[model samples]
Target chain A: MAKEPEQEFVTMTPQQKKARRSRSLALALALAAFVIVMYFVTFVKMDPSILNRAM
Target chain B: MAFVDKSALGDADFRLSEATAADFVALLKPRVMSLVVFTAFVGLAVAPAGMNPFLALVSIVAIAVGAGASGALNMWYDADIDAVMTRTASRPVPAGRVTPREALAFGLVLSGLSVMTLGLVANWLAAAMLAFTIFFYAVVYTMWLKRSTPQNIVIGGAAGAFPPMIGWTAVTGSIGLESVVLFLIIFLWTPPHFWALALFKSGDYERAGVPMMPNVAGDASTRRQIFVYSLLLAASGVLPWALGHASAFYGVGAALLGIGFVHYAWRVLAQDPADAGMKPAKALFGYSLLYLFAIFTFVLVDHLAMRMIG
Candidate 1:
């Protein structure tokens, strides 16, 4: 049987973990806001007859 | 359990940042951003052509974010000077709340995002102006003029002045004489406003090795220059009416505000050098903020009233 390689991990302090979590949440929120803004802008920029094109 | 890897990575490399959301916000300089947003809104409102309310909001937000990004870049570049100055010592990069690298990355990302968003949502002209404003603030003013010259504020003020012009372009898709007048108002107002602060905070600039007007020129010269700039700013404030763009109501308001500014500058100019409190300088600094706010508010109100009546 092949010897199992040892796994390596770096433990984070509680403060570090909390900070990472907070940053992650903030990034998610920012991305969501950007998506919403882009959606609205797309709607605003499109011609009113965009949806009326023949199939 | 996995083996703990203390030796695999250096301690410095492994150290996780403890910076919070508030730290990032501080890097953006919220107070300055508020002024930029307000001025840009007034510019948009006064444009001859109207924009969709939603698009107008988008343009304003993008400009605000662009201004904030420039602030972050400034903090990043001026971290050394900021660490020594009492006024800026608590800033994110200097205070160690955020690393300079992180601040730079944040600023760059926001700058790109804001410029791209404005171009997609508004006209390319406004977006280009926003990009240039960021470059002027971050590279030209913060990196070069701020450290090398006493005329730093005079030149750097152009970056702040561009937002109103950019706002105007977003609507008209081109620059106008009216927008240029708005730009000139802030441009001329900057010298007196900042020199007043420099008069009171000369020690801070001196300690940071920054060549503020008061630190480089004698206090008397700085005060005199402040007075001269105040005179020009007063005239420029009334230019909208003089140029036949704004109504007489705006002209009156502008003239009154201009007189108030000159009065404050005069006090600074006439103050005794022996006075340690520098009360006149401090007062001018305070009034300068009000002067800019009131002038822009007058323009906005005048425009709206004209639209209603005409």
Candidate 2:
């Protein structure tokens, strides 16, 4: 497996850091989506809207 | 990654030499420093009194630097054992990329810088906590308990649990019961968290002769201790909201997470030895990360919400 970004630090410009941040956010969202799908199928079918409501 | 070949740097015609600025940087154990910084930040954010933003920043930076200093000193002292352990074989001092004297100098400098900066930027109370944290990690854990007994993680965990209280002191300039509660949560959480890793990394301790729980007591005893500590950790997880340091949102979230922790512990204890049973221990280890993150995250969030609404 590839090393996680937070596990190592590399010097980068502000723009490079922005790009990296976006990539990380995208990956995290994708993983969260996968978990949500798995839960709905295998476990509970809760509404995603509940998150906003809880806030 | 292949562990055996990881330390080729050690064989680069390596004689113990003075470490450069970069090697000294690595000695601080930046990975552990991040977790310490995060929890400490949460503690500062949730403290009853407000602190100056720049001073708060300075305090957090100083605390992290102090933690790194402690790590460097530990690496310097433990270089002999570290060179033999696969996991730590590549550390600067152990790998001969750095000399012990160089690491010692670097740690001493950082320890002084962090403590002095914290005192100037924050209150003396916060600075004292930072200094004490470095001393506890360097002297108590690294010098004392690490070699003396297998219960090192249990006692030495106090060193790791100091961040939240330190952060709290930075803002309040005095210790609060709530801050102590935060410390207790991490204190209780450490044993099981570390013991699980020790369970799987049994060979590492045996090879290094570190007297880890698995190496000294036995696997069953380690597992039982993990379960007991997890039980206490779960109880402490709910204490913040129960004592009214937090609000309902935190209370409910903690209860659920506490149940999840207990469930993970149960699976680790009752499961049979096989590929199948590995999953639970692994799950507990993984969730344990989330457990600490969520608890501190909740504390910060709930505290922020109250501040805004009030």
Candidate 3:
């Protein structure tokens, strides 16, 4: 028997796709914010003496 | 357009409803998180050494997130039992609003984020305490003690009690007698508070196969244990004032609340096991919530007053 060609598939409706995109964007933004906050906190916690010495 | 495998498309098409923000919040056990936050805040507020306002805020938020992560992990692990128990049947994981895998991943990620952020903002000691608290609740209590023994809440209570200690550590970078007092207050209070609920919800625990005190030891024994723990809790509640860590005002208020707690526990002890109303047990359970909140509120208020005056 001859093989049949597979049909194209649509995984998500437009609304669902939009929602997924928004969620992904929000998650990425949150991760970025967390990273920035941690960096700031680490900077704040650094020893003043160390900073003076570096300078 | 991107090429999509038909099998993958089929799987996606059959997907369950996407979890909403509300579902994620539900997984965090917000009520429990709120209590944890309040206690931790009180710990931070009352510590002898003050923290920068911004750093203190960060530490509290991290502790809250860590507490929430533990809650999510607990829900993920207990989904099976939660589904069978009426009290927890509607939780995100068990209610099918969130998948177990999703909850687990969310919990692990938040746990890491909270601990690392806290370590950056505060000392490692505070971060270590938060990490241990999460692990204790999720692994020790949820996975081990909850199913194996009736004394699960007794030991699991330590996880809840650690927040204030962590808060104190964030300030002083060390544990102190005051933090220990706060820990003791919550630790001693847990048995009575939870056992009161167990008295009324024995059937739920039984149906879920949870070895709750009331189920394993009988109602009378559980009630007696509640009374004993209540006395201990009441004593511990007054210790902060007696130790001179808090003012006489806090001492008097805590003493009054402690007496009220013991009185309620006594009522629970006096009630007949067959009494359908279970009013005393129910009343004690409700008041225990109020008692903890009032005690912590007093701690915060007293600290604020002292800070303002002195």
Which one wins on lDDT?
Answer: 1
Best-matching candidate per TM-score: 1
Please give the ranking of all candidate structures by TM-score, highest first, separated by commas: 1, 3, 2
What is the Cα-based lDDT of residue B178 in candidate 3?
94
Task: Write one digit per residue (lDDT tens) for candidate 3, span B40-106.
Answer: 9999988998788878988999999999999999999999999998899998888886778889999
Quality class of the docking in candidate 1, CAPRI style: acceptable
Q: Local distance difference test, per candidate?
A: 0.92, 0.82, 0.90
The CA lDDT at B134 in model 2 is 90
**Model 3 deviation from native, Cα RMSD in Å:** 3.6
Native contacts recovered, each model: 0.48, 0.00, 0.17
User: Which is the leading candidate under DockQ?
Assistant: 1
lDDT of 1 by residue, B41-117 (tens): 99998999989999999999999999999999999999999999999999989988788889999999999999999
Candidate 3 Cα outliers beyond 4 Å, as residue runs:
A1-9, A13-22, A25-29, A32-36, A39-43, A46-55, B1-17
Model 2 clash count equals: 0
DockQ of model 2, rounded to 2 decimals? 0.01
How displaced is residue B134 in candidate 1, in Å?
Answer: 0.3
lDDT of candidate 1 at residue B196, scale 0 to 100: 92
Instruction: Report the C-alpha displacement of residue A38, candidate 3, in angstroms.
Output: 3.5
